[model samples]
Target: MASIVFAPADLVVATSDDIKVRFAGADLAAELPAHVQAPPGAVGVRVMVSGVRGPETMQRDSGFESARLAWYQQRQDGGPAREGSAPTMPGMLVLERVGALLRDDVGTECPSVAGQVGGDGTEWKGSWTYLPHPPEAARTL
Candidate 1:
């Protein structure tokens, strides 16, 4: 199964209806297994997060805060192409909700996201877990 990691900086918590995530391998379908392929026929995709600290512990604990990101898979028509051309890749990823990173209760809204094949396409099912980055140590110069 192909895996992608989203660092704290790579996640974007936009407005209520928008959330952006920039991680490696989003377009690595060719390299991933059939389930995780970027093509139309692929298996389910799972998205999750780690290193979540409760809102009350945000100030007391030196760990990262809680955060969530939800999404659904969809199929879009690629339109007509040359007979010898490649099939159009699906271009639909519907976000259900984005947790507030700044809030103590980010986990309240964000749920684990799992995406299955959009239509009759085959799929390569895999996990997409998002864990918090380790804090950098201070330099003692």
Candidate 2:
């Protein structure tokens, strides 16, 4: 199993087909050099996972292994610019599928996705556990 950590202020948007993690602006400012100019309303780094199947369940781990992963950098104009795709360099995302699991959370089983992704000296190894969404009433509270 792998572990992924996110700051409390990080924004994570997940759907059935994709997951996006946008770095916090304050974190970016601290990490980036003073000469680096971040566009307005855009984060410095964004990690995106797409083409994922069975993300809400563990019935299709094989398909998840083949999911597409990519990262983007914000342009000077607040748009995403794809990073590092030279012919000699490996692709931005290289999957090393470790497997998937269903975690027992107080008797409720939740989907857990674990894998190693990246290439050419950069890699992110982590597992993401997804809890079911709350009911409408719960959300309104």
lDDT of candidate 1? 0.26
Q: On a 0 to 100 scale, what is the lDDT of residue 123 in model 1?
A: 14
Which portions of model 1 show Cα errors greater than 4 Å?
A: 1-5, 15-27, 30-52, 56-96, 99-141
For each candidate, what is the lDDT? 0.26, 0.29
Off by over 4 Å in 2: 1-95, 112-116, 119-124, 133-141
Against the true structure, candidate 1 reaches a TM-score of 0.18
Tell me the tens digit of each residue's lDDT in model 2 across 1-141. Answer: 122334344443332223333322121111222343444432222123322323432333433333323222233334444343323211122223222333323344433222224443432222222333222233110
What lDDT is obtained when candidate 2 is compared to the true structure?
0.29
TM-scores, all models, native as reference: 0.18, 0.22
Residue-wise C-alpha lDDT for candidate 1, range 69-116, written one tens digit per residue:
111111123333322333321211222233222101223222223333
Predicted model with the maximum lDDT: 2
